[model samples]
Target: MRIQDAGVIFGILGIVVMMVIPLPTWLLDFLLIINFSVALTILLIAMNTKEPLQFAIFPALLLITTLFRLGLNVSSTRLILGQGEAGEVIHTFGSFVVGGNAVVGFIVFLILVIIQFIVITRGAERVAEVAARFTLDAMPGKQMSIDADLNAGLITEKEARERRRKIEREADFYGAMDGASKFVKGDAIASIIIVVINIIGGFIVGMTMNNQGMGVTQVLQQYTLLSIGDGLVSQIPALLISTATGLVVTRAASDSNLSQDVLRQMLSYPKMLYVVAGMLLLLGVFTPIGILRTAPLAGLLAVGGFRIQQTKAEEAIKQQVQAEQEEQEEVRSPESVVTLTHVDPIEFEFGYALIPLADTNQGGDLLDRVIMIRRQLALELGIVIPVIRIRDNIQLRPNEYVIKLKGVEVARSELFLDHFMAMSPGIDDPRVVGIETKEPAFGLPALWISEDMRDTAEMAGYTVVDPPSVVATHLTEILKRHAYELLGRQETKQLVESIRNQYPALVEEVVPNLFSIGDIQKVLSNLLREKVSIRDLVTILETMADTAAYTKDPDMLTEYVRAALARQITHQFRPPGQPMTVITLAPNVEQTVVDNIQHSEQGSYLVLDPAISQKIYQSLNEQIQSLATAGHSPLVLTSPNIRMHFRRLLERILPDLPVLSYNELDPSVEVKSGGTVTI
Candidate 1:
């Protein structure tokens, strides 16, 4: 067993031993001294405690100390009543200490018992009972406060748990104290009874049994002194313990210990001390007598106030000097330069005027909206988006905001804090009066309008959105478009860990075995780049495990994984009960691209003739335009072999255009050939 557990067992056993077995006089004397020391230590600790909860074991300790003292009392009573000499310590306290008088020591012992039993123990017990009731009654309010802090994001789950644990401990400690306070009162009553018994019974045994005809004076004096000494020793320690219990129960929780808290509060206003000192000086001058006493006391008060002020002034100077030194050190340190070397993955910066929209206190739902956005991305994109740092930049325009990806601006926009954005349903406008502008997300012609125009704009079949909603929608699209860039090695590792919890075998076999995390991240990134949700990660990795045997290329592995996840890939574009509209490349164009394809250790590339490449590009652009005019985002349907190559060719020129292989689409998804790209 542990030392603490062993010590607990040993202490209880020792208390029992002291009660049942007679101890030598010296050992009994030593135990009595220890009992007094324990009580004194408890009182000091109670005074210095910052909070009752800080000394949670106080109630239990109180009970143990009470029992130990009772045990010591029994042992000492046995020694004194039977032997007529308890110990040197008791003799000194009873006779020599009290000028060889028994009555005075008896009175002292009775006074100590009265102070403990009637005053300290009674008060602490009442306080403990009331504290327990109040704590139990306030539990719901305290719990609600903790919940509020958690919901406000002021504390983490771990911190919340810690706070809850502390509340429970407080309740239990006070409840225990309510019961344990009885031990002290009982010990006091028992001490008085034991003293009486020792005195009455000792006199009978000493005079009648031992001397037979001994004088009453000698017998009474001998037994009475020892009894009084025993009572004095027991009662003194009990009083100290009772006082400690009262101190602990009465003290209010604070950051500082009792002494420090008392000093700080009493002297918080040094001017009060100065005022009192002035009043004392006036009294000394006007009063008829005691000027000597009053003047010196006033001088001391004034000097104390001055010293307090001087100490405060020095502390403020020291703090300011230390702060300046720290600032200078930070400027000179290489750590700041080292910090600059690292960058946040995503950062959202808004103007000062737009602060209220993001500030939690100002009713900005932006932070909360950002959390929802992250969850949405995690579910849809199957990637954990990095923490998006939001900050205010005074350097930017008052109405403008910037979203940075890897320390560079990817999207920037301006918002009119006083108005909403209204967009026409199509290219046509209903002649609603508003400021003409282009939408940031889609470049659609839009208008900024006043709150009064919102109802009219909606009635005219226009899509209207408030400023915050507009920002949220724009952010959603931005996160979706750049999901690939955010899926780094670290994010991949997190994904792997999550997957391991569910599919340990698959993750264990694939990661660091078939491929590294970087390789996995690359494949996942490639899938995301095509707006494919890698949510079917099990199938994706399984496909990768099968395909990786032949090739180690992440690009080739991604294509195979996409083919394996054809159903998911198709569901994204081809909604249920909706036929997929696609534009196909002509057979000759595909063959010509395939014929000119070059492959080496670095993988596939196209080396088509410039004229032919230009012709193909133009044809595809024309078809894409026609498809756009028809209000459809048409996919480029090509043979599986040339799909990747054709997509690679158009990546730079037509990056937004999606190219899919025939095999990668669900066979059940009806395909309508919108047009043909011919060369």
Candidate 2:
């Protein structure tokens, strides 16, 4: 009846109960209990110990042993229950009997064993993973962030003083737990010890029971044989099933069509379920040798799928990189073509002329000069050319200033041809792909075009015309068009420069009221002054003047002057009477022009809004009411950017009425042209 005597009595009764009637779930419950108890003991010891190694190494080993035992028990039971007699008979016939290949059967058997091992390993892994989560969840976030110099517990005032008396240590008082090392060491030691102990204890117990004549050993021995044999046999099918199971699980985790809850439910089933399915399917195959071929084929397909995914990802990445590289290349390439010409005069009418330039070392000097000239032209034209295809023939006359000649020309011409041929033997040869002709003057005319030119024209749905006809006459038109496209107007550029030059006094006065960032100083600086040609100056000035409207405060006034001057220059110089302000502008204005004027709050400006003007015509009823109301006797508006239609309301209303502009408007009146503007 004493406490010690009572404890002994209870222990004996408990052992009797366990041995007599084994519960199926009892093993699982017992293992979990042992696992938690072992963990609790180690955790308490770790908290008290200064060195983590004391608790770290032993505890993890104990847990692993518990996991292994649980997995072994579960796997054994599952294997026995799930065993298919039909499947085994099929495996036997297909592998050993029909296939006549014991090697294949043995391999299949080994695979099954491996599969069982994998299931056990997976269960063990999952247990460990869960334990890790528990450990992390219990850890204090702030403690986790503790510095190396810190200890497991905060240093007490007394302890801190004592520690300070000694040398300062670099490492923390509570060293980090070597989880992996402990895991290995604990599992190895505990497994070996427990296994040996169990085997020896079972043998002793068996002999003792036999000597007692209880016949307990006979029953146990039979069960032991059956369990071990079944355990072994179970492994063969398990191996194939487990492998298939792993793949399916991983894929489901990645992209399952099932709802999350459904997927979770499916996952809850022991992964060994897949192993069972795989084994059944494998065994059902008529030929056991098929497993050999089927396994490797399946494995190869899995590997190939992974490789294909990787290759596709890499290709997409490469394509993105190549596109970016091309974009950068386009940005960096020069804008226009300008090189030495070698085409004969007769062929010049065809548009493009080739330059006779060789890649030879000696010709580098000429090439450099040509490149310099091309660069200069690009800067002047605000364009960059990418390619220069040179011709293969050239005729160079040295230091000759002959205007015209009769008889002397024949001898001179023959000598020139001979010299030229000698200089370039490849010239005039039939083997050359390019043309070689002689008649009249001969030289190459440089052509320049910017990428922007092509892109801008393309956006407007127009073809890119690089080399325009009537070079001399069209040069002005080309400049105007380019200026219009880029700076809004050709005159705007000229106006800004004129203001910069003629009104240095006015610029100094009004500039302070204009530029906000002080950048206007550069625009005003004589040092920044470029000796731009008349044409280029006009373009630059116009672009600069247009920016004035948008310039930060301190710039509004100067911008206004620049715009007014630009307007005047575009109009062609005119002297209207100072007393009257006659603003003879386009009648039906573009919406954009109207918007800009409406927003130009710096000063009042005159504009005929197209919408309002059209409304007036609707009210007037006459065909030319819109034009007449806006004071446009003969209405005209035409450009790629602008299109307007006006009925002849004036002619319909009063055909004999005097024409307004020709009669009253000043002949010296200036007009603005080009760009997004109204007539």
Candidate 3:
């Protein structure tokens, strides 16, 4: 052990030695000072600590202090019995306290013993017992809370582990305190027994051996005073330690220590203090013997109350001024403007009247709906959507709301909270009349009908939905459409960490070695832009890792990932038993585009003339319209090399159209040509 740790050991061994060997008067007197100092130090520490576990070493310290006091009792009793005196410390303590009266001194020592052994020690022991049981019983719940925090990403694994260790230490501390309390009770009883024996034995020794020349009454008086003084010196420190034990055991867990908590709570209401001062002033005037004492106390209370009120006001003003200065600094700082460059991935702002749709007290479930939307996307697209911030804005119309992606508005709508959205089923209309509007999700004609008309609308085969459902559905659609914009390098890094558990080898081989996180994020974002599911990430990463060494272009890498995830991609647009009817480019049109494709170090672009580009755009639009009218999603089938360029050409004008290459089509999925795009 280091010298610091051995100090405790040496002190404990010194206590054992004091019990066996006799010490001179001066040394014992100094040790007496150290003993009282240690006990007072323990009490001060207990009062200042915020909670019990903060003083985790107290139980062991309690054992040491108890043993040291017991050893002091044994050594002092020996001195009084054999030498007819213990030390000058006890002699002076007995004389000053008892004033030469043995009866009074003995009574005072008994009172201290009664207070420690019967009251403080017993209560502390019971509290420790209950605390230990409760801490042990609550361990499972505390551990589960830590685990939940870890899973929710509120805390790291290291923090959770630390919390678990603290709980165990708490349980151990309480259990040890329960046993240590007994030592205190035993020490109190031993002090009484030792003191009684010292008085009897000291009187016999003084009469027979050393003080034979003195009378029995002188011997009895001298030894009795010495015995009471020795007992008082030792038990005083014992009393301090027992009180400290009770204090630490009874303390509740808090951020503030005992003194701060007491001051904060007691002085919290200056008005109450004013009332107290007034009452004391009244008492001073009404009572005959109270003016000198109560009047000054009343004056002090009034002064303290006024000072506290002034301090509280000053604190509030200081906080307000600091907040204003911070606001000014933020507005003037260039870095503050730069900070706005990083935007919230998803933002939902509503007008004043629409706040109830997101507020829980008004039966609105929009906040919960947003969480469900994220969970649904995670299950569907295998991407963890970033947090959606919902707040109110007074700038828009009262019933209007807007959803934004990366600080840019993607979708906006207005709703009537008192009405339901009613849409026609394309069958015969029953002519239900209400406020006419267009459905925000699908843009079909709809009406904001009243509650009474809900039944009528349903009877007419009309679809009905509440205002919250409408907003939630609109948010869901917008988030799904712009998901590609949300997937950045940071999000991809988190995904890589999550995927490392199942595909450790793939992640190790690819990330930062063959391809960086940005490279992987770009490939995934490209696929998501075309409404492709990244749920089959194992295949996506494996395919990219296998092909990234030779082909560094993310567009080509995305094509390779799409080919590997062909079954998943095809299953979304086409079922297993169904033959997918797709519009394919004619050979002449495809070959013309391929022949005119220009490539340079900057990047490749289609060099087709305006005439050719316009004709191709018109023909593809006509084909897509025909396909949509036939109730089939438009998929342009082409060769792999031309797919990326062909898709890019259509992206600016017809961004919603999905273009798939032949290699991306799964072999198990049946396919058939719907029509040819000829220009």
Predicted structure with the largest lDDT when compared to the true one: 3
Candidate 3: regions farther than 4 A off: 1-13, 49-67, 92-228, 245-257, 270-311, 329-342, 352-365, 389-395, 428-430, 498-509, 532-552, 559-679
TM-score of each: 0.70, 0.22, 0.75
Q: Summarize candidate 1's per-residue lDDT along 1-679 as a digit string, tens digits.
A: 6999999899899999888888999898888888889989998999999889878889889888888988987888888767777898777778875666778878887888888888888999999899989998988889888876665457888998999998898889889889989898899899899889888988988876774465788888878888888888888888888888888888888898988988998887787898998888888789875678688888898899999999989999999999999989998998878877789999999999999989879888999999999999889988778889999999999989999999999999989878989988875555577888878887788999999988888888889988998888888888888999998887777677656657889998998899999999999999888788977788988998898879899888888988898888888877457688899988899999999999998887889998999999999889989988988886898998888889889888987778999888988778898899998
Cα deviation of 458 in candidate 3 (Å)?
Answer: 1.6
Model 2 C-alpha lDDT per residue in residues 328-381, reported as the tens digit of each score: 877666641222223221111111121212244433233454455446535543
Q: What is the C-alpha RMSD of each candidate to the true structure, in Å?
A: 7.6, 26.7, 5.9
lDDT score, candidate 1, position 406: 92
Candidate numbers, best lDDT first, in rank order:
3, 1, 2
Better of 2 and 3 by TM-score: 3
**Model 1 alpha-carbon drift over 4 Å, by segment:** 1-27, 38-71, 91-232, 235-317, 333-335, 340-342, 349-368, 389-398, 498-509, 534-550, 563-567, 584-596, 610-631, 636-642, 661-678
lDDT of all predictions, in order shown?
A: 0.86, 0.35, 0.87
Better of 2 and 3 by lDDT: 3
Candidate 1 whole-model C-alpha lDDT, 0 to 1: 0.86
